[model samples]
Target: MSALRIEGYVIVSADGMLANAKHVMPDSLRFKGDQEFFNAALDRTGLIVHGRHSFEGQPNSPKRKRLILTSKTAALAADPSNPNAVLWNPAGATFDEACDCAGVRSGTVAIIGGPEVFAMFLDRYDTFWLSQAPHVRLPGGQPCLPGVPERSPQAILAAHGLKPGEPQILDASHDVSVTPWRRAG
Candidate 1:
């Protein structure tokens, strides 16, 4: 069987901007407990799927299989150094097929994102790991899951048949929360 997971590190303001899309990292925003959470997530993931922007944002790494989902013609040429990187266009192959080809299988296939990618696989994902920043602000930026209505994350997850599973508060330093959700039936 195939398994899909949607995971993201998001920081949203009260008004709801996830983070600055233009900047490498958002302005005045810290990762909080992201390092530890991300490390754990990576350990469970067999393959990492991400948008071109998210792929580019990553620092150099030789480990893990990274797939970039894009419709661009010059996709591979854009990142020649990373030979392990593969460009997957949904037009050519569905996300599931690509993950299978990359040996994702029953193991976790983490779909990291830039909104559109999250939207595409929302219905298909069986798990979602969300890093919720309690008190943070990004004045002018894109939302973690744009086009998703102004509702609490719990409400949104419930609507999608995903219920919170394990939640760990990352201390009180950054006021961030890490929660994992599983699809219900």
Candidate 2:
């Protein structure tokens, strides 16, 4: 294990969903404040780890040093389209191996999401930046974590030993706020 600081970042609706049933994030969930916050945080990261859907959803993703989680590949393979990315299969290779492939030996590793990708790093996150669009609700939508429909997002984080800090309001007009959930000492 390298001295990697893993962090998770996500925004969810009132019902704790990341996207609609179609696995698409609707307009209601997109807030200027949240986008600004996410972008600023990502800029400070050394590496980005996410799934295919997340990769496609983010802007300027090809320019960043990242590992795209995928089961399609055997373990680790070069991403032909993006010179900065590598395809990683966690089952076939360790996180360290993926980092090596991406040449990210240390520093912060930002885990941006899509359910399965978010869930994979639950126990490993040093901090998880959870933003909320309290006014939005996605029924029968995709969860931010595996236990979401059955449990609240906060509860799941607490269960995984992460405690929520005081929330910072991102957009007061839209009632958007972000909380950093950190591992308990």
Best by TM-score: 2
Candidate 1 CA-lDDT value: 0.63
Could you estimate the TM-score for every candidate?
Answer: 0.79, 0.96
For candidate 2, the per-residue lDDT at 185 reads 96
Q: Best by lDDT, which number? A: 2
* Model 2 TM-score, all chains together: 0.96
Candidate 1 structure quality by residue, lDDT tens digits, 72-177:
7432322365656677778777666666656666677677776777667666667777766667655556766655437655566677787888877764686666
Cα deviation in Å at residue 79, candidate 1?
6.1
In model 1, the worst 10-residue window by lDDT is 73-82
